[model samples]
Target chain A: MTLLTSAVAAIVCTIIWYKNAPKNDMKIGILCWMYWGATIMWFVDAIFEYAELKAEYFSPAPADMLNDFFLGLSVVVFGLIIWLVILLIKDPKGVIKSALSKKAN
Target chain B: MACFLISTAEAVVTTVAAKQIEKNENLREVNVSEVKYSHKTPFSKKLKWLRNMLWGGSALLLFEHVWHGEIVPFFPFLTAASNPADAAEMLHEMATVGVTMALLVTGVWGVIVGITTAMEKKAEKEDAAQIAEHAEN
Candidate 1:
């Protein structure tokens, strides 16, 4: 489930990036890279879990699937938070900078 | 703190992006640091909305998880599950609720981007007309 969710997210972000490739915004590219990175991380995790569980991995119990699902969502959410923080720091669009300067004056 | 980490990450991201851009001969000598992203660019405006959507959606989801007792500051929360039936229900909630929230955020961002783009175009045309009128005088 983790693998599937992350892959879906990576694919969605990739498609968006592809459509806007000419513009090539850094923020969008960063987001795409983040999701793809997460997907790879979960892929490796799935491989390890499969190795440990062998056949049982192929038929994960509902509880195991649910756990994996939550884990995947957590990873996705964490990725967004990290991205948001970066966006805030960079103030890529100058929104935060203007807001802060306005508050200062 | 998170501010320090994000500043570090920002350096890494900017370096990577600049390196990628440098591969293009035309932009090879461009100073990435000197190039500040303008607030008025269409991409920037759209990204502003997207940032809001994602941050808001993630916050809402966290609140939901906390309310549902799925999240805790302990290891048990990582493995929370009552039984097979309960797990199935949880899976259903994740699929339905999680997907809906993501979709809602994306949909709103898309719509606002479309509207803003159109409005910007209209404003640009009006400005052009005014310049042409002034030049004729």
Candidate 2:
């Protein structure tokens, strides 16, 4: 479940990154990389767990799925927060720079 | 049980290496007049891309492991560490799954760097041609 969630996020983020590749004002590449890395990590994890559980890996408890889904969601949120920090620090668009200069004026 | 530790360890090492490279890069100066082409972003800045990818993925995995009680705030920290059998299995998983994930991410970053370098080269050639045309005008 976690793997599915991160993989979906990675796909959507890739599309966004591709569309914004020309402008690249927001640095969406960071988010794309983060989610893609996570998706791969979870994919490997799922493979190993499947090896151990075999048939049981397919049928997970509803509560466990819910928990895993929430974990995946949290991971996505955390990635967003990290990207936001990088954006603010880098200020690729100079939004923060302009705001600070305006305040000084 | 503690598969993510391998990636986490790699991240830690790379973070230190990145910092060192960044410091060295900061000390170096680019001679704009002597160079026909230059990278818009420095190598150190490019390394940050790999650093961010590794750190972000490792942090999320750490959180997930903690959520599942695979890790705890204790002397050994890993639940598998308490049992010799589980500890061995954990080590095996770390070797197989963890190392594979780390290598995959690093490999992807390498490809990204290659693409970026090629694009920069193309841009440099275009810039030189434009400058030559300006000179002719």
Best by TM-score: 2
Candidate 1 local distance difference test against the native: 0.57
Q: What are the per-residue Cα lDDT tens digits for candidate 2 across B36-59?
A: 347566777777787777877887
Clashes of each: 0, 0
TM-score of 2: 0.77
Best by lDDT: 2
- Candidate 2 chain B: worst 10 consecutive residues by lDDT? B28-37
DockQ, all models: 0.03, 0.58
Model 1 segments more than 4 A misplaced: A24-26, B1-137
**What is the Cα-based lDDT of residue B11 in candidate 1?**
31
lDDT of 1 by residue, A69-92 (tens): 887677677766766787778877
What residue pairs are clashing in model 2?
none
